[model samples]
Target: MALSSSSEIVRRPHPLEAAIGDTRVLLDVEQGLYFGLNGIATSIWQRLEQPVRVSDLCCSLKAEYEGEAARIEAEVLAFLALLDARKLIEIRA
Candidate 1:
C-alpha cells in the first residue's frame, strides 16, 4: 500500500531480528527469508519498534542525519515502501 506523511507504521511482530555490529539482520520465520539492514536502515527499523507517523519518522531522521529535509523524507518513504512490500511492517491509515 502507498503511504503518505500521515500514515502510521510499526514493525510486524513476526520478523525475528538480531543486531550484528552496526547493522541488523532480520529473519522472517514464516517465509524462511532473511534481510539485512545497514546503519541508517537499522536506525529506522529501531524507531519502527512502535507506531509512528511517516512525517514524524522523517523529522527524527533529519535531526540525527546531516541531509536536506526533502532528500531525507524521500529516502525514508522509499525505504518504508520496501518494508511494506516485504510484509515486515503494518501501515494504518
Candidate 2:
C-alpha cells in the first residue's frame, strides 16, 4: 500500500532495538531477522515511537537536516515504505 503525505504511522512494539555508535540495530525475534539503520534512519525510527503524519515527519526532517523539501519527502516515503513492507510499522488511514 502506498502511503500518502497525510498517512499516519507508528512503529510496532515487537522489534528489540540497540544503539551501536551512530547506528541503530533492530532484531525481530519472531522473524529471526535483523536490520541496521544509519544515522538519519535512526532519527526517523526514533520519531516513530508515536503516530505521526508523513508530511509532518518530512517537515521535521527537513528542519533537522539540510535538504530540499521534495527530496526529504521522497526519501522519507521510500524509507517508510520499506518499514511497512517489513511489518515494522503500522499505517493508519
Candidate 3:
C-alpha cells in the first residue's frame, strides 16, 4: 500500500497513562488494559506526536535505527496498519 498522511493523535492524560523504558507501556482506563510496544513501535509513536506522513515516518525510522531503509519502511507500514486496524490512529488525505 502507498504511504499516506495521518491525523494528529491527541493523547488525553485523563484516561491514558503511559511509561516507557526498554519497551513502551500504555494504560487505557476505560478498557482497563495495558499495551506494550517494542523499540521500533515505540519510536514510531514518539515521532507521531504531530501529524506526519507514513513515508516520513519510514525515513525517520531508518535514520535513527541504522537499519535497512526498505525493511524498516515495510515494518513501519505494518505497525501503522496494525494501529489503523484498531482505530488507534486516523488516516488523513
Report the number of the highest-TM-score candidate.
2
TM-score versus the correct structure, for each prediction: 0.94, 0.95, 0.73
Task: Find the 10 residues in a row with the least total lDDT in model 1.
Answer: 14-23
lDDT of 3 by residue, 1-93 (tens): 234434333223343537665877766667686778877787787787777877777777777778887788778777777766554566666
TM-score of 1: 0.94
Off by over 4 Å in 2: none
Better of 2 and 3 by TM-score: 2
lDDT at 53 for candidate 1? 98
Model 3 residue 69 CA deviation in Å? 2.0
| Alpha-carbon shift of residue 58 in model 1 (angstroms) | 0.6
The most accurate candidate by lDDT is: 2
Question: Which lDDT value does model 2 have at 21?
Answer: 83
Instruction: Give each model's whole-structure lDDT.
Output: 0.91, 0.92, 0.66
